[model samples]
Target: MEEEKILAIDYLATTPVTAKDKRLKARRDPWMSRVLRYTLEGWPTTVDNELLPYWRRHEELSVREVCVLWCDRVIIPRVERPAIIAELHFGHPGMTKMKAVARSYLWWPGMDKNLEGTVRACERCQQRVKAPPRALLHPQLLPKRLWSRIHVDYAGSFMGRMFLVTVDAFSKWLDVYATQSATTEVTSEKRKTSFAIHGIPERLVSDNGTCFTSSEFRTFCESQGIIHTKSTPYHPSSNRLAERAVQTFKDGSRKLETRSLNETLQTFC
Candidate 1:
């Protein structure tokens, strides 16, 4: 019989505890025990809800000596997850970067949420959150009153979140929303939120992004009694207020220190 080769996760090379310590901890872990047994023997027909996450991915799981692995990534034990999270977050790399690095090396149940929570709870990480590169600020046609004419644009994936940036042309008051999507639905929803506070604008200006040009968005604007205008195709600068609003958001976010992305955006304004 050919020997089964073991895979190594580069991130585990610098584990807080040694491999022997990890093996010892793994031996004491009930979840790891089940995973090890299932991989070495055969997966059971069914599992309780707590273990269902593991059962779903059993086919990709393997063992290296006594350590549990999900494909090439280490399945970190529950006891060591805090230390592991600390090590992963050592440099105060924000939630997004930490998650990306963790995916390359190790995993745990709720790892994504865990990583996000860690950074949110960490003061150093929150203080050092950076924004996208600064862009040139352009002047645009001013309007007569606040909320009469507004410029809108998308900014991100900045600090692991997309943002809908709205700038009132008359007042230059900024509103930023941390969003998971840049879809037409999300865009309109954000606009509605702004409208609830400041009332709907008479004219809305944006670049030629599909989120703005889509029929769905056009209908949304028409329904709201808004005059929607798009910048010349391939000439985003024509919608100078929104373009500069995005730049202002990026520039403002860099100097911000807040508990969450949404708070950072709110505080910047």
Candidate 2:
């Protein structure tokens, strides 16, 4: 018959040791070793009277055989503490679920408190917590004049070409320009051409796309004496003026199935 492997604490205390074994010992070794030694020998009179019942049940068994400390429940050995907890709490489960799983298995002193702390400290669990209440919307004042505030955005590769879309906040005037690329340089040049025709707007608004948020784009707006404003990150309604225009353009383009790209642009113009 195969001999039962001794508990970790018992093996460490009785076996011949090397310098490496001493260095690799856990911080709780002293306390665990003493507990194992006391368990192997008969319980002393000074031992906690509260544990008398547990000792009576387990006294007949060797230290390796009765690794569990059954005072409250079957308490796991110190060496297996972290691994057992991790297995019970895998997938960063919520506190209630973790507690339920832990209670179903071998336990330790302060197990509930330690589980709480572990779950609380988990970065993934913290991130998955419900977000705080969203603040109320504070809408921007309506523009008093045409071209005073302009919203810009990009739409489509309808015919293998993207369009730079601009919409005036007050007039609701829409301008769509087919572009070879959506790079900052290309977009800035397109905007410059439009600015020359319509005059530069007091405020230019766009989404947080790379073309709009680029340093080059900001410099271009600065040079033109235009205030550049970006809509709230991931909030499309803030730039609804440009979004509506893009939708309108796409809806109109879809109907002109027989028309070529140039013909479609001419019809829209």
Candidate 3:
């Protein structure tokens, strides 16, 4: 409706064509050109309110013109469709905005089938309805040796008690501590016990949780000669191994049933 209203053309007249020339020779398609020109002229009025900063800046381009030029000329002809789909799913600002941005580029494939299913199967969209593409930050480095690089994170408790896990970077060994309260004092005591058993690590990596960020924890790390490292506030990849470990655990769990269903059932029983 907005596209039709903004383009000032009957939707039926603007048949979707997967032609690079559509955008390239946009000025030549008399009917389409008039609609695109008018849309571009009225972009400031129609899209100014709905779009973000980047999209807003392209107000000089009509809806059809922008779609044709940006989609066909820039995206379809040059960029791979799968990559474009991924970028649409992950790299864009928001889901709604991404779809809106994608609509401009979406065209009949140049001798391909319907892309609706492919577009819908995007994982990011499946996980988050309309989340914006978060800018990726640089990976942080550990300031020490292999096992000395300790990463502690809490997980599960989805069905049972939460487990605080300390992972060794080298051996991929995990030391899990089941805890009732994730208090600063409790966490400190657990860390001390862990250090006593496994010896002090050169560096410790953790989320910016209250327990991890507490003065007591910092003092404890300082006292133990262990450097405390806080992960990027919300980014998990700061200690990327944690993600890998979780995936490994999930994969192994999935395999357990398949590799030996009888053994798995026996073990559970």
Candidate 4:
């Protein structure tokens, strides 16, 4: 009997793995693993157990290979099987439906319990969809006088393009100048010309982008009798007015599907 069992195992081992072999495929499937683990103990083991014979036959297959075969043959064939599984006498339908969705994607062997744990951990489903954005700590009251506090910044360049932005705090008046480069040499010259046309403002707020923080920009501000201030790192709201104006221009430009920032700035102005 033992020699016969060994011969059977050897014969099964020589068989090529294929989808047509359901008995071979089930041994590798995680869902089937769970089912077998729960119920196989109740069945008497023969001289050569069914699982041992199958494993001997497919000893060359890796776990991942087994999973792929199982998915392709078993899981994909019954695409909505989890939903039907949900119908098989269980808990809340809502809970069951979620499990159904999760199982549809996450149902590899050993994942059934982990998927349930993940479903339990979702806070969004536990509560409402959204909470109102926290109240703004600093409401932006527009400066009462034009040019009393100005915001200036550079946008777009380093790939050989540039646009300079200046906005009057009160009127929200915006001026955009296209520059050939973002270097101090080009930016300082452009600032001089812009301020010459619009007159120097009391304060300039900007981010710490290299174009704004350059030594040339500081010297230009000093020469123009303008006070230069910078926003906190990554915190654009420190230069709120100028920041909002820039966003408005970019968003409108994108919505209009235009190539020219000049045209977008013109619309905003």
Clashes of each: 0, 0, 3, 2
Ten-residue region with minimum lDDT total, candidate 2: 1-10
- By lDDT, the candidates rank as 1, 2, 3, 4
TM-scores of all candidate predictions against the true structure: 0.47, 0.46, 0.39, 0.43
Candidate 1 Cα errors over 4 Å, as ranges: 1-140, 233-237, 257-259
- Estimate, for each residue in 193-265, the C-alpha lDDT of model 1 and write its tens digit: 8899889899998987889999999999999999987878576436777777787677557645444676565
**Against the hidden true structure, what lDDT does model 3 obtain?**
0.53
Error of 2 at 233 (Å): 4.6
Residue 114, candidate 2: alpha-carbon lDDT: 82
Error (Å) of candidate 1 at residue 182 is: 0.4
Clashing pairs in model 1, backbone N/Cα/C closer than 3 A: none
The per-residue C-alpha lDDT of model 2 at residue 109 equals 57
Candidate 3: which pairs clash?
39-62, 40-62, 93-132
lDDT tens digits, residues 1-269, model 4?
Answer: 33322322232213233334534655655445433443333323432343443233232322232232222122321233343333321221224554554354333333355445544554532332243433342435556677777787766652245667777877778877777766777777877787788777888888777877888779888988888889995764477666666654444444444335554445445
Q: Model 1 compared with the native: what TM-score?
A: 0.47
Instruction: Give the candidate order by descending TM-score.
Output: 1, 2, 4, 3
- TM-score of model number 2: 0.46
lDDT of 2 at 237: 45
lDDT (Cα, 0-100) at 241 in candidate 1: 74
C-alpha lDDT (0 to 100) for residue 89 of candidate 4: 13
